[model samples]
Target: MLVNIELENAEDFVFIKQLLEKIKGVKSVCVKEEEEFYEDGTPKWFIDKLADYADSLEEKDMISKKDFFKFIDEEICRLNSQK
Candidate 1:
């Protein structure tokens, strides 16, 4: 038997997929949209800036994993504050 369901969000999709997979008769549960699993598009300027920033990173500038995540959190908060 084939069944199709539309979920409200990624959380629901994940929850439902796991639940469906537990059923004994089910063979597979797959997402129909490739965009959900793949990068659709990104702004060219943002991509270029990311590439440039990556290239600028040096061995000396490397930080611990904890500090790296802290920096990311700080940057996210800073960007959010701008809005």
Candidate 2:
């Protein structure tokens, strides 16, 4: 049987994997790290939506990539602070 476990800390993976491997019926254990959508931790879906919104904008309303990233960073910081 394949079981998926989510760990709170990456450091705990090796310890957990070892423990699972000792179980009698276990076959093999595989480790897969969590996938990252973007380097800045932005979700791919959100980026796609942003791209669609930008595409719909008029030429004069479009913003530079640097400014766009600055806005995204600020938004992320603001959202994280609220939590």
Candidate 3:
């Protein structure tokens, strides 16, 4: 789910502190940050496969383990505030 978290000052800039409340009640979350996951040199097979999977998820399930790991790592640090 996409949530617009507005920040006013340096205090509000600490929105990461609210991550616990944010994730209080949720299921699987697929976070695709444009600033992080965007690129140009993508393979045609990858593009076609993702598009095909998007169309028929139940028929042929396909997901990116590489991106999934990256997202999980990010969420872990984001929650822990280790960065």
Tell me the whole-model lDDT of each prediction, alpha carbons only: 0.83, 0.89, 0.61
**Model 3 lDDT at residue 45:** 65
Steric clash pairs (candidate 3): none
What TM-score quantifies how close candidate 3 is to the native fold? 0.26
Per-model TM-score on C-alpha atoms: 0.38, 0.41, 0.26
Best by lDDT: 2
Q: Model 1 over residues 2-54: C-alpha lDDT tens digits?
A: 99897767678878988999999999898966323226566566777789999
Model 1 gets an lDDT of 0.83
RMSD of 1: 15.5
Clashing pairs in 1: none
Better of 2 and 3 by lDDT: 2
lDDT of model 2, residue 40: 85
Flag regions of model 2 displaced more than 4 Å: 37-83
- For model 3, residues 1-83, the per-residue Cα lDDT tens digits are 65654444546544654553577665433433333233686766677779987887662455588978999999998989965
Poorly placed runs, candidate 3 (over 4 Å): 1-62
* Among all candidates shown, the one with the greatest TM-score: 2
List model 2 lDDT by residue over 4-81, tens digit each: 998888899899989998999999898776755898889787889999998899989979999999999999999999
